[model samples]
Target: MSESPSSSQQQPAVGADRPPALLVNNIEVIYDHVILVLKGVSLEVPEGGIVALLGANGAGKTTTLKAISNLLGAERGDVTKGSIEFSGERVDRMTPNDLVRRGVIQVMEGRHCFEHLTIEENLLTGSYTRSDGRAAILNDLDMVYGYFPQLKERRNAQAGYTSGGEQQMCVIGRALMSRPKMILLDEPSMGLAPQLVEGIFETVKRLNEEEGVSFLLAEQNTDMALKYAKYGYILENGRVVLDGAAAALRQNEDVKEFYLGISASGRKSYRDTKHYKRRKRWLA
Candidate 1:
C-alpha cells in the first residue's frame, strides 16, 4: 500500500528504535521569577525529522523554543522545572553557545540578520562557532546558496536592504553554516508571501531529506506548517492540547474546525458558532 524510501532517503525515523535529536521532558518556564509561561510542556524531534509546534500568539511557542535553546535567561526567563536533552545529553543547564557547539542552533523569529552587515557577512557570522577551516565554511556557503539562489545573486547587498524573503533565507543559510544537527526555527512564515512560504518550506524539506538536518519549527500558519512537518504539536494556554502525525492532524475534526478554519459540522462554520460551551468542547 505504501512505497518504501529509496536508499538515498532512507533515514530512520525517531522512535524507540532510534533516539530523538531533541527531547523536552515536562519543562516549566518562569519569567521574572514569578510569571509562568510554559506549563509542563514536552515534545520530541526525531533525528532528521521535521516537527512543527503550532499555536496562536502568546501560546508559549516561542517561549518553548527559547527554553530548549537556553535563551530564556537573557529575557529574565528560567526553566524552574523539568529537563531538556539534545542528542541524549542534558542541555538544560548548558549555555546557548555550548548548545550551538554541540550542533543545536536557534533561528529566532523576525529573521534577525545584522541589518548593517552584507548578506554574505551575516552568513559568515554563523561559522564563528566552528573551528573548521575556511575551505569548509566556503563549501557550506556555496551549499546554502544552492538552496537559496536569490541570496547568491544578492550576496553583496546589505541585509537591511534585502527583501523579507531573502532575509529569511539568509538567516536560515547562516544557521546551516554552523553545520547544525538540528535547527530550532521560530515563526518562519511570518510576513511573507504565500509563494515565498512554500519555497522556504520546500528548501527545509530538501535539507531534511538530503542533508539529514532535523528541525523543530514554531509556526502559527496551521495549514502550511502541517503540510511540511512530519509531526505536529498544538499549543493552547502554554500547554500541548493536541499532537499527532501531520496527516492525521490535518484530518482531525477539532483541528479542522479551530486551527485550519475548516469546520467539520455541516451546519455552520466554526467561527459562526456562537456557543461558548460548544467552542470549549471543540478546543478540548
Candidate 2:
C-alpha cells in the first residue's frame, strides 16, 4: 500500500532528471513448489538514499531483500515473475557472487561473519573476489575502522571472540569491501544493544552522507529503521501494506501501534539491562 504521490506532490521533492538506483517491479516469489512467499512486491531505492523495508516478523522483509539481491534460486526459492534492475541492468536472474562482483552485496541477518577467522582476516575475505585489491582494501578497512574504531583496535583478534556489535560491524565492513553501489542490509539491529543499534544506524547514516553508498535495509526495529531511512514500505502478510516518507510513517499512529510497536521501553530495556553494558567491554 505504497502512497503514490501525485505528480504535483512528489515527496522529498525530487527533480525529473535522476532515475532510481535500484528498481524492483512487481516481483513474485514462491518456495517448496507450492507456497508463495511474496505477492507482486514493488519498490525503489534512489541512489545515495536509505530506504527501509519495515515490518514485523514473517512479513517478507528478508525474502524481499534476498529476492532483489538475486540470491533466490529456483531449487531453493524462485522469483516466478517480475524483474529487478540496478541502474537499468536486469539482475534478478544473476548469481549471488555475480551480483557482488557487480557491486550488489547483502549483509544478511544475524551478522553472518566468519566466526573462525580473525577480524582482519574476516574483513579481508570481503575482498576475495578482488585479486589485487590489497591497498584499496586497506583504505576501505581504514574507512570502516574510522566509523567503528573498535574494529581497528581488534583487527587481528578472532572474530568469534568479539561481541555482537563488533560482529555486526565486521559483517558490514565485509560487504563494503565489495565496493557496492547499493547494499541490502537485513536486520542490522536484530540482536544488539540499544546503543549499539544507534551506533550501527549512525554508521549507516555516515556512509550515505559521506560515500554516497545506497542502502535498502530490512529491519524489525521499526523505530530505528524509520529514523535511518528517508522512504519506507511496511510489509504485512508477505505484501507491502503501507509506504511513505519516513517522517510520515513516524507520525502514523497505526504504524506506531501495529508495526513499530507501542512501547519503546521494550527496545530500551532489552538494550540497557541485558547485553548493553556487558557486551560493550569486549567490543570496545
Candidate 3:
C-alpha cells in the first residue's frame, strides 16, 4: 500500500504528466476577519481525476470548496494565504462567475434548486454564463438529460416538489449544463437513502469516465468517497491529517479503525474505550 502524506507535507501530484485541473496550495481561510476556519490546507485534482475530501462535519470541507470556487467573499470569508490555480493559471483572485466561465463550477451542498422553477428551468440557469449560442446549450441540456434520464421524465415538474434523490440529480444536471471541465462537488450524498447514494456515486463515476470531467468531492461519507475517488485527503479541524491513494487509505490501520469502523480484529465502535487515545495517536 502507498504511504499517506503527513499534515506538513504536500501530497505528491497524482498524475505528474498531466497538468492539474485544480491546485490549492497551503491555503488559509479567515471568516469575519477573526475566525480562522481553514489552516494551511492543500490538495490537487489531476485532469480527468476524482479526488475526495473526506472529513466529519465541521472539518472545513465546505469552507475549502468555497475557497476554491471564490465564494468566500459572500460569507465574509477570505483565503488569506496560499494560491489556487486552475489549469496552471492563478484563480483565487477571480470572481465565482469568472471561475464558472473558465470551466470550473461548484455544485453546492443541500441541493439549492429554485423552488419556483421547473427542473429544466433550474438546469438551464447553469447555461446563463455561456455565450456559445443556443444550439450548443440545447445540446448540452440533452446531454445532461441523457445522464439523468429521471430528470427528463420530470422535466416540467417544479423543483420544490421533487424527491430528495431527483433534486440531487437536478442540481448535478444544473452544474453539467455549465459544461464545466472540473466540478467541486460538496456533500453529494447528504440527506439521501443508502441506495440513492450508491446510484448518485455510480452516476458520478460514469460522468468522470464518459464526460472526462475532473471532480474534487467534499464528503463525510468516507467509505463511499474512497470507493469512487482515485485519491483522497482526510481533514481534521481544517488540516489535512492524512492523504493517499484510495486503496492505500482504505487499507490503512488508522483509517480503518477511526473512519471505517473496522480494525484487525473486527468492526469497531466510536464508544470503544481506546477511541480518544487512538485518535490522538493517529493525529500525532
Candidate 4:
C-alpha cells in the first residue's frame, strides 16, 4: 500500500488549537479474529469541529467509525492495536452504551431506524442511555423537532413508511436526542436526492455552528463531504492515504484526479487507467 503524504507536505489538522473531542491513534481492526481491516489508522475530530472521513465503499471508513463507537463486537471485530480517546478519556474499551452516555453516538449507515416503531418512538429510543430524567429528554425531543421540522410533522407516522429523506432525518434527529458532544455520522447522503443531500449537509453545518456538536462524518460522496467538512481524511484499503484542510484537499492534484473525477486535462474516468498505475502515482 502507498504511504500517506508526510506531515510537512500537508496542512496542519483543522482546529489543532482546540482540544480534540475524539482521537483514534494508530489503531488496527481485525474481523473474525483473522482478517485485518484497518492498518494503523489515526485521525482526530476537534471539539465542535467537523471532520470528514472520505473514501469509497470498502475503504474502511465504516469500520473506523465502528471502532471509535465500540460497535465492532457485534460483527466479531476487535481493535487489537492502538487506542481511542474521547474528551481526554481513554474509551477504546468502553461499551457502546457507555460511549453513548459519554456523549459519543454513531448514526449507523443505511438509516437503521426501527421499522415497527413510530418516528417519535424511534427518536425517543435514542434517549435510553440518559438518566437525567424525563423532562430533559422531552426537551431534547422538541429540540430535535426544531432541527428537523419534517420529523415533527411525521412524528406519529411509522418509521417504515417514511420517505428515505425523512428516515435519514429521523436517525440524525434521534442522535441529537442523545445530546452528543461528538457524533460519528455514517453516510448521511446515501439513497437521497441531490437536493435532499444538500439539505442534510446544510443541517449538519447548522448543528455544528449552533449546537457545537463535533462530527466525524464517514461518507462516500467526496465532493459533498469536502464541501461541508472543515477538514478531511481520505482512506484507501484500510489506511488514510491523504488528509488536509478542506480547501487544500479540494485543490490537491491527486485528490482532483481520483476522488473528484477531475484532472488538468479535463474530467476523467477512474477506470480509464489500470488500478496499479493509479496506486503507483499515489505512492510516488
Candidate 5:
C-alpha cells in the first residue's frame, strides 16, 4: 500500500539511521539567570523535509529558533544547556554567520529585511558569503524572483514601502540567497490575509520540493504548517508536550480539540469525560 524511497532518494534522515539535515537535542535556554525560556526542547529535520514546531503564544517556539541560531544574546537569553548538530557537526556555539555558512539560516520572527534599501539591494545582502560576489548575487536574485515575481516588479522600490506579504517574501528570498540547505522560518503567515497565506505556503512547498531545501518551521498557523510538514513537535509553557507524524497528530482527538478545534471535546479530556468523572472523581 506504500512506495518505498527510490535508490536516488535514499539519503539520510536527521538522526542515526540516516543523518538528519538538522538535529537539536535536549536544549535549555535562560534569561536573566533565572527565567528559563526553552526547557529541554528536542527536535530534528530530515533532509528536504519540513518539520513544524507548534504552540500558543509564550510557548518558547521563537526562543528555540534563537537558541539554534545563537541569536539569543541579543536579548540576553543564553542556551544554558544542550547541543545542536547540523550535517554531523556540533553547531550550538557557532556565530550566526557561522551557522549560515553551515547551511542553517533563520528567517527570524519579524522578517527583518533592510527596509531602507531597495528590494534588490536587500536581496543582494543575502549572498554576502559568496566568492563570486555581485554576479553570483544577481543569479541568486533571479532564482528568488522566480518564486516571488511580485518582488521582481518591485526590485527598485524601498523594501519598507512594500505590503506586509511582499515584505515577507523579500525576507525569505534574502535568506535563500545565502544558499542554505535548511531554513528556520519563524512565522511566515503571522499577519497575512487568508489569500496571501495560501500563496506563501505554496511558495514554501515549491522551494522544498524543487530545491531540496529542508525547513524547521515554527508557526502558530497550525493548519498551514501541518499541511506542509511531515512531522511535528508541539510545545507548551517551555516544554514539548506532543510530537509525532503530522497526520497522526492532526487526527488526534485531543489535539484537534485543544489546538485545531475539529472536535467537540475541547471542554473536557478523554481521561475525565462526564462518564468517568461521575464515577472516578473520588479516586483523584
Candidate 6:
C-alpha cells in the first residue's frame, strides 16, 4: 500500500530481463453495453512468476479473469477499451478456444468440473486443444497425479462425488493438462479448511517453481495468497488501488488491518468489529 522503496526492495523485480507472460493494459469491461465492471484496469504477470489479485466480494476479480480468457462474451460482457496482450500478441479479439491454443487457460472460481463425468474424464477434457499425441498427454496425466496424490487416488471416482478440496485440485490439474503459459486462477480457497488452503497454496508454489508456469490468481484469502505469491495487486471496486511485492504488502499496515484483518494491537475477530470501520488511506 505505501509503495515505499524499502518495501519495493524486499522482493526481486519481476520480469526484469524478458517480456511478461501476460499483460492487461488500461482495459475496461462493460456488461450489456451499459454497466461498467472494470474501470481502466491494468496489470501484468511476469513470465514464470506468481502474482496474486486480492479483493473482497464483488470486486470484479472474476470479470478480469474472464476478460483475459475471452469468456466475457458468454455473459454479454465485452472489453470496450484498452488492450490485452499475451506473449506480445494482442488477444483482445481472440476467442476463448484460441486463447487455450495459445496457452492461456483459466480455472474458474467454482471449480466447474463435469459433474456427470469421472475425475479422469474431466481431466482428459483439458487436452482437447492439444494435438500433441497420447504419449505426451499420458505423461502429463502422470505429472498431474504426482502433484496431487489425492486426486490420483480418486481419479476413478465421479468428480461430482469428490470433496470440495479434491475438486479444486482436479480443476487445477485439468488446467495443467493444457500446458498453460499463464493460468488465470480464481478463488482457489473458496470453501476449504485452513489446512487444506495451505496445502493447495503449497502445491501452487511448487508448480510455479518446478513447472515454470506463470499465474495470475484472484483470491479472497489474503494471508495465504500473499504468502505464496511473489507479487500482488489489491483490487477495490474493480480498480487496482494498490500493488507491490508480496513481502511489502505483508508488511504494509493498511493491508494488514484491512485485507489481512490484523490490527496494530493484535488480531481481532472481524465480524465482531463491524461497527469499528477504518478508513482506507487511498480513499481518504
- Tell me which of candidates 2 and 6 scores higher on lDDT: 6
lDDT of 2: 0.81
Which stretches of candidate 2 lie above 4 Å from their native place? 1-17, 262-284
CA lDDT, candidate 3, residue 223 = 93
lDDT of 1 by residue, 1-284 (tens): 13232223322334567677798877889999899988878788888899999988999999999999999989999999888989889999999999999999999999999999999999999998999899999999999999999999999999999999999999999999999999999999999999999999999999999999999999999999999998998888778777778999899887887789887556674467542111111110
The lDDT of model 1 is 0.87
Q: Which segments of model 3 are wrong by more than 4 Å?
A: 1-11, 265-284
Q: Which window of 10 residues has the lowest lDDT sum in candidate 2?
A: 275-284
Model 4 over residues 158-266: C-alpha lDDT tens digits? 9999999999999999899899998999999999999999999999999999999999999988999999999999888888877888999999887887788877987
Name the better of 1 and 2 by lDDT.
1
lDDT of 6 at 56: 89
Q: For model 4, what is the error of residue 26's alpha carbon versus the real structure, in angstroms, after optimal superposition?
A: 0.6
Say what the RMSD of model 5 is: 7.9
Q: What RMSD does each model have against the real structure? A: 7.3, 9.4, 4.0, 3.7, 7.9, 5.0
The 10-residue segment with the lowest total lDDT in model 6:
275-284
Clashes of 5: 3
Query: Once superposed on the true structure, which residue ranges of model 1 sit more than 4 Å away at CA?
Result: 1-14, 266-284
Q: In model 4, which regions exceed 4 Å deviation?
A: 1-12, 267-284
lDDT of each: 0.87, 0.81, 0.89, 0.88, 0.82, 0.87
TM-score versus the correct structure, for each prediction: 0.89, 0.85, 0.91, 0.91, 0.87, 0.89
If ranked by TM-score, best first, what sequence of candidates would result? Answer: 4, 3, 1, 6, 5, 2
